[model samples]
Target: MSMGTKQAALDGVGRCSRSRPQRQSGVALLATLILVLALTLILGNIFYRHQIDVSQATGSLHGDQAMLLAISAESWARDLLASDNDDPEVDHFGEDWAQAIPLLPVDGGTIVGCLVDLESRVNINNFSSYTDTSLRAERSANANNMGLVKLWENLLQNMGFVVDESRVSVIVDWLDKGDELIGPAGAEQSDYSGFNPPRFPANTYIADTAELAAMAGYSLAEVQRLMPLMSALPGPTTININSAPEPVLMALSGDLGIDFVDMVLDNRPFLTLQEFYQAIDIRLMVGEPALAIRWPAKLIDVKSDFFQLNLEVTLGQSRLEVKSIMQRGESGRPAVIRREITVVPAGVTTVPSRSIDTDDENAADFSGSGRDRFSDPDEYDREYYLRPICEIADSYTTGDLDDSGEQF
Candidate 1:
């Protein structure tokens, strides 16, 4: 009776053990499937994000490539200038000043270039020195306030100050004199009473062309009118006649005639003293033989062996710009002396406005197409050179107040 009862209990115990083990194995398989699915979903999300980042990175790289191409166009144009020897006007593939350089594989937009006379605008940086008769006369007999510089002087002069006593001279004095000293009875920190960047000698030249608006005599309206036509560059006081407009050429004269203005305008430039003098002698009047003109060119405004090129580019989501300035060096007649690149916010620029005269009063303003985006060297102030110099002028110091090296 004891043996039979023990056998039945042992069989029941074995069955219970086998069933428990099978249920545990099934639960383990379910957990494994869920774990695998979770890992697959996590990996898919990571892969999707990685693809987005890669796409963004590729687009950015393309934009950089486009910007580089835009910069290359500028270099190519500068090289053309260096090789030109004596030819002016950029004798291009076409007669247009802003000749398109053509879009290529990496380039995102069209690029074009033009040369403007560095000397055409009044050198606002020298306002202090121009005021100083003793200082300015040494530069040239023609150095007396005239042309675009005189236009500005006349503007201020018309407002109040005596021609010689005008604030323009004070500004000239500040720029021309390396030593920061207010002339006798002139404005200086000692005379400023309490102003910053004193009206009198501040012992420094202008660091920024925008600083001119802060000077005592200039009105915002007047400055705005005159500013577009002038610059504060290393070259003070002189605007390159070769690069000047007909309006500037007419203003340069003490007394001007229609024929004279036309004559000067007909010609592209008069940089060399002989070239200017000759151009003047050849009278535009019908009755006059090539008689001598009244004024002699005393000063020469040079663009120097340097130039600045503006480049803008867009590629995919990347957008950039470059303010590149290049220098002529010791290697040869016009070898590359230095090169600098300045990047600024995209879409910001100082593009010039344009207008065209017509017999019809109702003429449309179709000249939007005529706007010039390339900033003429004259459009800058002498102080404007500091930025390029800071970036490009090696063997020089940011400490310099004026750049006499590029004087015209």
Candidate 2:
């Protein structure tokens, strides 16, 4: 009986030991599974953050590359202007400097650039009354002082935009030192104070054309239309006959018509004032009554000193646009007066092509003969003011230089 009892007790103790070990193993396995799952979650979060950081860094790099490309294009434009300085007699669309840059392939991107003559357009600052006695005297003496206002009116009308005479007067008031209101079209501090967010008239000269939008009554659409035909240069500058658009040419004188503008453009890049006069005489002999009036030689010139360069660059998924105003010095080298940079979305395919079709029905009928001359030109050909950069490159490669220092 003692032996049987001892054996049963030993068996019971063995069973208890085995059962405890099995329970301990199950607990250890559950803990291990929980630890593994926690570690996986932590690692996954870290990996996701790392991927995000890498993507942002790549995008930043692309943006930097795009900016550099735009800056490089501006430099190239300066060089082109410098080259034109050698023969400063004329600035015309036919010249190499007026050519637009085509899409050029670069490292991880493409670039497009173009140069526009600021002097070709009317200077808004021409109305400003500066402390310079010489400038003041010129403003009073030159008939073009009023002529500029007329020119702006003509340009707006030609573009199918209703000219706001009051707005125009306000611009004139802004320029003149005197506080006297310019008839019904002018504005002063009183007019601006009436706004909910009270604003004041800029009594001084404007630096940017966009500032015109801030005027009391001007619309954004109207300002945008005027931007291409107007500039805000520091001082009074003569319009470059060679580069001036047909509308601007007509605005030079109310007597000047579309036919006269076409004649001037057809025989462009006039080497001297005498040459321009000779052309006018020829038009006069042909019974063009508009040509009978004396051209305002003092208010116009054959060359330009100020130009604007627009550059667009794409790098990977990033795009950048740069606009720079360059002023040509006596040495012919252009100095950057202003520069603006903007970032656009990646993969934007709005890069302007080599040739832009004038299919837009809204385009202004430049010819004022009450007919859409742009559709079909009989006597006057509306020439392309901006040529493709590829064409200019080809001209250079082929050494196709004409008497006017331009490629045909």
Candidate 3:
């Protein structure tokens, strides 16, 4: 109650208030730190799970894209080997094949493909057939190798490209020569060059134009120009005049006393080659025209009723690799048997080739426009066959398919 007692009580009350507030502040600070740590742990877990989900989804998409493209490739190949028609010439798209992402209507999916040509495709079985001098030599020499080369060369030359001749010769040597030698520029694996990869001595026989990249001096550009004009077919020497070109015919006339290059070019797709041959400038060259000169049947004008295809496809977050071999039976009906190798973890797979159903006739939804290829009898057939099928494709092929005529 006294003045001194009142002052002391006020001081004690002030001290008590300060101590209680300080204690509360310390507890609040500790709670805030713990809350921050808990929030950080939760956010980290959520982000990590989200990242895993994104990765899985990405892989799945890639796998699907790869597969669809593969199927597309097989269809293109079958169309290639369907029929030897003069029309719808496979000049563009190189060999009636396409790659990269393409949209399919059914599944509304995108796919990348590598369409292959089974006819132009080399048979690993015939790898060494070029080396058989006796079996293939006489025929090779007798046929119009000159015209064939010229047509192929002209295709490249006209396209404004210059090729390495010596290196090309090495390719020919590799394909035809029986004996093997260390190819030109034989170096260790580390020293080869072509892209970032060191590629040397392409010893393996080429089964298709795609393999041309493996050959020395044969750039992708050069091969692209030559692909439509050539095939990795039965090594019968001559090229069919029906499918041969003016440049090739000119070369033929230069070599043999057949000045029919212009005639052949001027009027091609003749019903019979003999009709075109009759128009040759027989009197232009003074030498005796060898009437009995029987040419070997090195080249045969043919259309394969059956064809096979190999497809490599890639789709977004998914992958499907198909080694599909479509057999174009009689009437050019395709019977596709796919060897599918899929790479999607959870995507649904549909393999339609194994079954025979009305709806499944084209379950793959493959396309067909026009087709052509090479054909040779297992044994040498003396019968000379030179005739092209009816022109079926309106946009891509030509009726006159030649620079050299297959004269045997």
Candidate 4:
């Protein structure tokens, strides 16, 4: 072979080797870019999850702090009510404890709340007397036993609900410790089983007004509407005429017309039951004498024993609401009978200023634990024989009429 031809072949082989190396370098560069992209995506996902976990943990911590603040506020309320017992014979909106706890800045946020007189509203548990079969039969035989039932009927009418005796019967059946129906509208486990997701009747005194709405013939809206005027106290309690809403005062007796209610409302914060009676004597005299005679004197008083403390605590990102029921006996020291707490959502605001709501039992989140002290009121020897101030004046002692130990 010629030397020139051999040199040409060697040059061609060198060019081919150089081109192969360039192609391999390009592939390696692409692979390195792909690896970096995959790692970046993985790290980004991890960082995002960590941020979410941190946020959730922070929220939980804030909620715990808010709850503690709310509990502390509850203790403060108990003491306030205890001190107010110096004049336990009278509890009215004009009193110090009735005033609201204004929004006060705390460590992390703010706290606000107010006290409610539970006695100012009708107690649904008053009808639990129907649970006793013998008593039920006896009450059924007497028109006087039907006084509370009639009052409830009137309240329903005032609240725009259709007045049905069955409505009251159903509520009684829910509270009665019997499987037998109280009336045509009464409900039992059998009736409850017909629901989509079956529910059973409580068959005992309810701790929450939500239970009242759960019964047949009652709606959530109706219960909410009545929330301002009704309570599910541990037992039967008299209405505090001093603080009762106009609707409640009107419900006390069918004869208590709006004009009569106005008289009670305008001159109220009555210092004594006698004072309340005097304020309405003029109207009572003018009304039908028979109806005036039946003025439900037994169902009312000027003082109260049951009160509710509603507190709202806000800490950082968390807002908590608490409701506590307190029972103040003759000793005058208030004891918590029930408590409930709820976590409110962000971006929602409730009236921070204090206002009166009949009972906290109306809240859907009624998860509280406490023992209730209950004493059934004495049954009247004569059902409709309720008397006013003049009749009781001769027998009424100065302190005998205090609500803590009141007989009627």
Structure candidate 2, residue pairs in collision = 166-185
The total of clashing pairs for model 1 equals 32
What value of lDDT does candidate 4 attain over all alpha carbons?
0.69
* Residue 315, candidate 4: alpha-carbon lDDT: 86
Tens-digit per-residue lDDT, 34-96, candidate 1: 999999999999999999999878876866676667656665656655644534422221233
Model 4 regions more than 4 Å off: 84-86, 131-146, 183-199, 285-298, 329-332, 348-408
The better candidate by lDDT, 1 or 3, is 1
Better of 1 and 3 by TM-score: 1
Local distance difference test, each candidate: 0.45, 0.68, 0.42, 0.69
Candidate 1 Cα outliers beyond 4 Å, as residue runs: 1-52, 83-110, 125-164, 176-186, 190-208, 219-224, 235-238, 257-259, 268-275, 282-296, 300-306, 333-408
Of candidates 3 and 2, the better by lDDT: 2
Clashes in each model (backbone N, CA, C under 3 Å)?
Answer: 32, 1, 49, 0
Per-residue lDDT tens digits of candidate 4, residues 1-408?
A: 899999999999999999999999999999999999999999999999999999999999999888888888888888877855447888787877777788899887999777888888888888788644544454464343226666677677755567766777787888888689887767777887766456678777788876776777665546655666678998778888888766666665454456656577679888977676566666655443343245455577788889888787888889987889999876668888898888889876655332343223332222221111011133223122122211222122111222222212
Better of 3 and 4 by TM-score: 4
- Ten contiguous residues minimizing lDDT sum, candidate 2: 365-374
Candidate 2 lDDT tens digits, 1-408: 699999999999999998998999999999999999999999999999999999889999998878877887888888888955446667777778877888799988889877888888889888664333443353355453325556667667665566665646667776676567756657777777765456666777888887876675665546644666688987789888887765577666455455666677678778876677678778566432333234555467888889888887888888887879999777778999899887877654453343354423223323221112223444354443433333333333333323222222
Q: Of models 3 and 4, which has the larger lDDT?
A: 4
Candidate that beats the other on TM-score, 1 or 4, i.e. the better one: 4
